[model samples]
Target: MANPKELDPAESPQAFYGAELRRLRLAKGLSQEALGALVFCSGAYIGQMESATRQPQKDLSERLDVALGTDGHFTRLYPMVTRSRFADYFTAVRELQEMARTIYEYDPVLVPGLLQTAEYARAVFRAFDPLRLAVETDELVSMRMERAHILHSPTRPRYWVVLDEAVIRRVTGNARVMHGQLAHLAQLVRSNRIVLQVLPFSAGGHPLMQGSLTLMTFVDAPPVAYGEGPYRGQLIDDPAYVENCRWAYDLVRSAALSHEASLALIEAAAEDYASEQD
Candidate 1:
């Protein structure tokens, strides 16, 4: 069998954290499975953390400290592994998304970031942080808008989105904002830059009722799945885990309306919002 690949700790903060975790675990004569059991997570998750494919959560890091007798080493380094503007768990996903050749998404609520108009995005950030200063909101919206560049890149990924009808039905930023948001989505579809389908309320409960999911495929690396949860997110790179997410996404996609039908629905929503504003 091939030798286990060596990790270069200096490559990144995440790499360093993973390397330290592995070293501490081995010194204690505990396998990944053992450590995971002590921490209430899966061995595969621990393996992903060691390989630097996943970031450790604050809670998990604390548990690792207690279990490995590392005296808070992992916890101290956790903040360094995260990006200031993004959640710690979402940093890896954002990096992978930048390199992906194709992106498939299922959003149960709110417009996906890549498709949000500036006004709509600003509204979202403000609502999420009503107490934030205006400058802070601007900075947040700028960061989100910067991510939209992926949609305009020359080597842009093939984008496909399946939206639950509630995403469009909800009035996020009043009638004007909803109208612009839906119109923007329709424009992307008309430009043939994206493939979109709406999973109508009539479809009833479905495979992705849990939350949002993004499956990204790369030209030179294995696929990954990023799942969103309340106040946190998860990035899955394990082959088997990614495949399972892909299967679920396929089910959700199948349950959505046909492309033509979905487009019509979006256009009608936009018109309704516009009329409401008038």
Candidate 2:
């Protein structure tokens, strides 16, 4: 087998955590598989953590600490490793989205962040936290815009999204903002950059009616499911749970309008917004 790559702890907090994990495992004379068994995770997952390709999760860190007899060392370091501009729970989702080979998303109330325009995102942020300062909102908008850059890349993930009709009807910033956002979606659809379907109100209740869901598949890693609500998000990597999420997404897709019809509806909504702006 090829020699394992050396980790540079200076690279980032995650890298540092990986390095520390490796050090403890080696000190205990344990192989990745051996350590993984102790922690109740797969050997490959341990390797991914050591390579800084996967962020360490809180519960896993606690388990690792107990398994390695680290006296809460890993648990204490978990927060630092995950700290980012994005919410703690969303940091991993953001990282995985960039590395995914295919992405399937379902949102009930708002446009998915990957497809949101600057104005639309800004308005949503402001509305969610009316007391937030302008500078804070600006910072968030910039980060979100930067995240969307992956969609423009040549190797961008195959993106498919199902949006509830409410997403299009609700005026987010203003009439003009809604018009621009819908127009942008139309352009993306027209350019074949993404596959989008609208889950109309007429479809009635669905499997994913409770909140938003994102399912991402990777070339080298296992698939993951992310579910988000107002302020909380959960990322699931367990094979069984991820499979269930995939099934739910498939159901949502089946209930949504066809691509052509969805585009027509989007265009009609854009026209309605345009008229309101006038």
Candidate 3:
């Protein structure tokens, strides 16, 4: 185990994409602002997409290829970079996933990001980096689905997650995929390896009204709580802060449906979606 090689900004894949985007922009004599205006996105979004800080969606991907007149490079570049899950911002997500012995997750909208179905996860990923094609979305989805293997490892962590009822009801993708997703959601619930609870909208004015959070406790260090929004994320390591978040989670659990009851809710939703499919 020697020191790892330092990565140069010009040598990395991100740099490659960024440099190429910049070259195309300069070659066309278009400013970032001008390119952003044409794409119907912000200048910063254009910058981020070019820097490979975010993936471009299908429409944007095609637009870039045509806008830059690069036969097909940007179109091909979109998926080539979009397939990675944590990407450049949340490398810690993967690091934390590997470190924790017990993972406590609270998802107020959809399923805990970790427990998302392929389609659901893809939708989430697509929502982040909107210019990827279906192939890229599928690739990213596959990468995320494979991450669930941690649940079955020889020394699996104790994973407890709470979901908002709307998560099960908010169908993602087509009716068939939604049906399959609900089934997968129910199957995971029945595995007995996890304790999952669902908080309904009817349980109005709940304690944690904002969004999703996760408290991951490592065997060797103090517990840490991580929170995320659609575009931002934070990792909390301080004892007082983590404790406060844990307390809030404990109260949320009290207000949510019991584990068995939650499973029933998920099962019923799965059947509902399944019935529609038949």
Tens-digit lDDT track of model 3 for 1-278: 11112334454455466677777787999887788777676665566545544445667768888777889887786665544423443555655675579998887676665677777787777767888898888887887877788887877788998888877777666566667776776777677667788888788886578878888886544577778886767665556778999999998888899888888888888778878877
Q: Pick the candidate with the highest TM-score.
A: 2
Tens-digit lDDT track for model 1 on 3-50?
124678887788888898888888999888788899888675677678
Q: What's the lDDT for residue 198 in model 3? A: 89
Cα error, candidate 2, residue 94 (Å):
1.1
Q: Which ten residues in a row have the lowest lDDT in candidate 2?
A: 82-91
- Compared with the true structure, what per-residue lDDT tens digits does model 2 show for residues 227-247? 987778877676778899999
TM-scores of the candidates in the order shown:
0.73, 0.77, 0.66
Give the Cα lDDT of each candidate.
0.84, 0.87, 0.71
Instruction: Supply the global lDDT for candidate 1.
Output: 0.84
Better of 2 and 3 by lDDT: 2
Error of 2 at 122 (Å): 0.6
For candidate 2, give the lDDT: 0.87
Q: How good is model 3 by TM-score?
A: 0.66
